[model samples]
Target: MKFKHYNQQQTVLLPYSFDDLIPEQHPVRVVDYVVESINIQPLLKAYSKEGNPGYHPKMLLKVMLYAYMTNVYSSRKIELALRENINFMWLTSMTIVDHNTINRFRSNKLKDSFKEIFKQVVLMLASEGLITLKQIYTDGTKIEAQAGRYTFVWGKSIKTNKAKMLTQLEDLWNYAQSIDNDDNPDPEPTQFKEINKEVIEQTVAKIDAKLSGNEKASSKSKAKLRYIKNNFVANLEKYEQQEAILAERNSYSKTDTEATFMRMKEDHMRNGQLKPAYNTQISTENQIIVHYTIHQNPTDTKTLKPHLENFEKTFGKETLQQLKEITADAGYGSEENYDYLQEKELTAYVKYNTFDKEQDKNYQKKNKPFSKENLYYNQEEDYYVCPMGQKMHKTHQSKRTTEAGHTQSLSHYQAKNCESCPLRGQCFKAKGNRSIERNHNLERHKQRTRELLLSETGIQKRKQRTADVEPVFAQLKHNNGFRRFSLKGLEKVELEFGLMALGHNLRKKIAA
Candidate 1:
């Protein structure tokens, strides 16, 4: 094992410099081209004039887009990279911007601007034959919000807790005073060492003021105060327990009051806990995201029309008209939604509950055909025919008022007729007559459904919706680490969601 040692003198030389390492037309370089193509100078000019002195909006946007593309969401980390990482250096034009500035830009003016920029990119891709505007898939996925579910305090609960806290304080003060009197041998000494009456009175007055304000506070405002208090308490507890957990090998758990629990699927207690999030909706055509929105609404049914309307505004009238089919899962299914699609003359494959296997399986086997779709309607008779070929005559037509104070003309069918019919067991179990209530828009819904079922391409496109949309959410949660939002309120949550969608679209584009 004899070896010869010599003074280090040998050196290796590289053929190319760091600048030459990256291709001149790399996707990173295309950042500038994309920005220029979108024509964001006016936005930059506006922001610059409004107290943002030297920083260019394009530079900030490019940095953000690059961050999203790479899945580096934290503003501080992005700021650190600019001063260190070569790729970020080049992307941000070698300018080092602070994390606060980066964050402010993303959270403030950049949200709307990025939304418009996303649309422009989608349009650009469409023009380049990279995307087709004909068929689109729409879906929503819940991302955890910045606030915890526990932080959502009901007004009733807050009132109860405030009263309890006040009582506790009063009892503690009384006990402390009793202890002082018991220990005091002289009355003069006890009087001098008494608790500050002014402080107690002020605290009581403050509590009373809070209670009075609660009566005037909106439900939303009350929730916000509770959220802040919960966060404050949780943070305090976290710090107090930090030291005790430091030495233990298995007990280093911390609670984030501002973190809400959400999930991709409704599985109670899994691998790692997820937090409160928004339901992000995205509309895609030919695998490119054309329209996107983020909502605090936990459900998907309410988001369909708004997102579609936003899509129309983003792409212009001609491009919107080119959208032949809108596909969504059972979550987007509603009679109103179907009517809306029909009014727009847009084919929709919005699956109603009957289409979902879990829901269908829960129904009695014989009753499955009793679904609205399976009930044969005779256009000539203006009535429904049972599966057993028994006609359900319109017994009565009367105007009915809804809880919302809207009147509708409802035609009721004979329940007695259904009782003796062979399809009675399948159709209705009610003691009274089984009725079919038709809305004024019933025809519109039927037309929409007819169009959707008849179009071969539309049907095929609808089948592809789950494949196209669900995977986006899967990647966002499992791969991209975007299970919950880092911000609060619906608006900020929405902005965060837009960023996530932008990230997804950019990744898809790059991969394609």
Candidate 2:
């Protein structure tokens, strides 16, 4: 018989142990080596002085990072891999860490250490000249939180409902007063500047104190008080609690109150449902994330300032001095951001809304008369000449406020005579006056940014930006399949994200 005999039971001794099974270039090796390089004594301080020994933090950190590199996110899945996968066994040295312990360490022990560990990894890359830190391509993406979409609490909804409840509370208060044979039964409704649970509780206490002082109760008065206590008081109190939850957040998910509702890219239905998610901001260089931050803001406009502040704090002012330029998309193109970049003396090639239109000659010609740039402006006189030869003289300078609370001076121009203009229909949509308000400050900043966007360096930056940061997000979301977060609060999520970034950076080092 030419066929070799094969047995079900097989036992053999190997020349080398599991340590030799993994190659030197393997990512797990990098993970282990980098994790070992980090000083985890601060993390170990949290443990009890005397107890049964637990898994070393280095072993656990290596396991978690290796799991992330392999696209295994769940703690349970990592646990299974540690027990089953040969690579995991080689990484952990055959140590079995339960899923709960892994989850605990991620949520608790590594919360503060994630930042330090991630910083160490980035600094290592910088020292190796792998990360230039000269050019930071910043961008943000929405990642779903571990909260239900339907469980949402909106600030507007709470305010509106609270107003109605206050009206009901007043009506109930009046009913109780009327039962006491008081002519002032219909008291004026309470005008509250802010309504919350504490206010409602205080109001309830006042009513109770009045009832308690005059203990001799009539049947009718008793029934009215009961109704107020059971219905009106209860509702106001409930509304107040809801208001407490709505503090500082525009909208929060009921299941995960810390998570704000944001539209996600992974929503296959594209229904534009506001799911509980976070706007994760990342600054990447050489296809590796150098810095990252988690924000509650859905728009990317407001996140840049604080993100960089954190960067400065983490890497110091000296580190920012080493940066030659910064590039971001149109979402981060606000006047404040431009001013910030200018103040920092870092060359910014950030794109604004008008940047693309300025480059398109056809668009310029098509919208010339309507567009502010093409209109004939008498800067000395502060007047604009329209397409129909109508002169709009600058009337006043007004301060315009933004959602972020930064006020800018806007020069308002009004047409001298628009009552009988031939192009009134095209020029003005209103009945009386045609007014145009321009933020000259913002416009000037935009003009400066426009020049930067069209320069040779700007053109080079635009092309480099297209290739730098986005691929890091792609690697995290598509390659690693990290679309939704399993952790709950912002701090915990930040920790996990930092770990993910660490894993990704280490993987990049290994690949390099």
Candidate 3:
């Protein structure tokens, strides 16, 4: 056997660049290419001309995105990569950026401008014929926030505590009135609107003044009054502030005030515990994330409008004009969403909650023979034929207002008689005749969706949807291990995810 001549101290005559050391088809090259192609004036504007020039935002962006693509999310690890990894060195041209600088650039500098950067990348991808922007497959997933799971503030808890305080205040006020001999009595039932520190202080002072030196008032009650005077005001103010932060959300994480507690599917314990997470909604075209939005609400139905609105705001309404259709799972199938899709003049291949069950013949025939779905409706007469062949006439109409403020008109249909009926035991669970509510407009929309979804084109789109969009999440979360956010606040987390989304697009491009 022969061994090749190798020397530890051998010096080369030629000096080659870091580019020569990297492979031509490396993903790092693609990252550099796509990032360099985008207009980074938004990122450049973050810097001031007065001070000494910092590490180029362009370089930092490339490095951060590449790091995320490779599953190195920590800033310190990225800094280490810049020093140790050959590909990273080549990408940054041997410029080693410190972790603090990297974190600052990501957390502060990229916060406002990341959306533009992401849009530019998507546009670049569009130019390359990767994404059509014709039809978008939308889906939402809950990603855990970079906060302690137990550190949560529930709006319900706040309201309950506040209610207790109100009760205590009322008792104290009534006691004060009963004991006081003054002719000028305090107003009965003080109306507390938007409880604040000032309101509590004023109420406590009045009660304390009336109760002071009164023999009828017990010492324990006096101590409680003092306690209320000392703590109730501060506690009420805190609850008020928390409710303000909560807005429409039921709960928020104390560590990350913007992060709402949501039930995530990635439950390691299998107990279905609610964790502090953000509802991440993304619209994809040809497996590339064209647009994304972070929402505090956990429900996907409420997020569609804002997500599409942001998509238009980022890319322009002209971009939405280019969209021919939008497809999503049952989570996004709401009357509000359907109406929005209709208003946008875009075709919806969305599925409602009962779509799958409606497809099952056994469900219709055996499982729910007496259910509203199995009943036959007469469009002309506005009545439904029940399982017992009874005529369920349209009795009245009602309207339901959704969280998004969209009013849904529904017609109530009730069976004329269920008493002494043979199927009464099976059908009539309530005290009176069996009734059902139907949203005509929503039913029409569902019928249209059913037609579209059952069509040949709809079948292809439906099949392609899971294959196209799901792998993006599977790759990012399961394969690449980006299940949780690294940043605390919403804006910073959005920037972080934007970087990851850009990385995903670039990686997909490289794979192609």
Count of backbone clashes, every candidate in sequence: 11, 0, 0
lDDT of 1 by residue, 375-440 (tens): 777667877876666677777788876432335566666433555666666666766567776653
**Predictions ranked by lDDT, top down?**
3, 2, 1
Which regions of candidate 1 deviate over 4 angstroms?
Answer: 1-18, 48-52, 155-268, 271-275, 356-365, 368-378, 384-391, 398-409, 415-451
Query: Quick one: ranking by TM-score, best first?
Result: 3, 2, 1
Worst 10 residues of 1 by lDDT: 185-194
By summed lDDT, the worst window of 10 consecutive residues in model 2 runs over 181-190
User: All candidates' lDDT scores?
Assistant: 0.63, 0.80, 0.88
Clashes of 2: 0
- Candidate 2 lDDT over 315-361, as tens digits, reads 88998899878999899989888888888998888888768766788
lDDT of 3 by residue, 1-512 (tens): 99999998888999878988888988988888878788889888888899787988889888988998898999999999999999999988899889999999999888888899888888888988988899999998889999988998999999889888888887778888988878888786457644566667778888888888878888988999989977887787788889999998899988899999988888978899999999998989888999888988898999999999998899898988999998889999998999999999999999999888878987667647777876899999999999889999999999889777889899999888789798888875899889999999998999999999999999998898898878888988999899999999988888888888888888888876
Alpha-carbon shift of residue 17 in model 3 (angstroms): 2.5
The candidate with the higher TM-score, 1 or 3, is 3
- 1 or 3, greater by lDDT: 3
Deviation of model 2 at 82, angstroms = 1.7
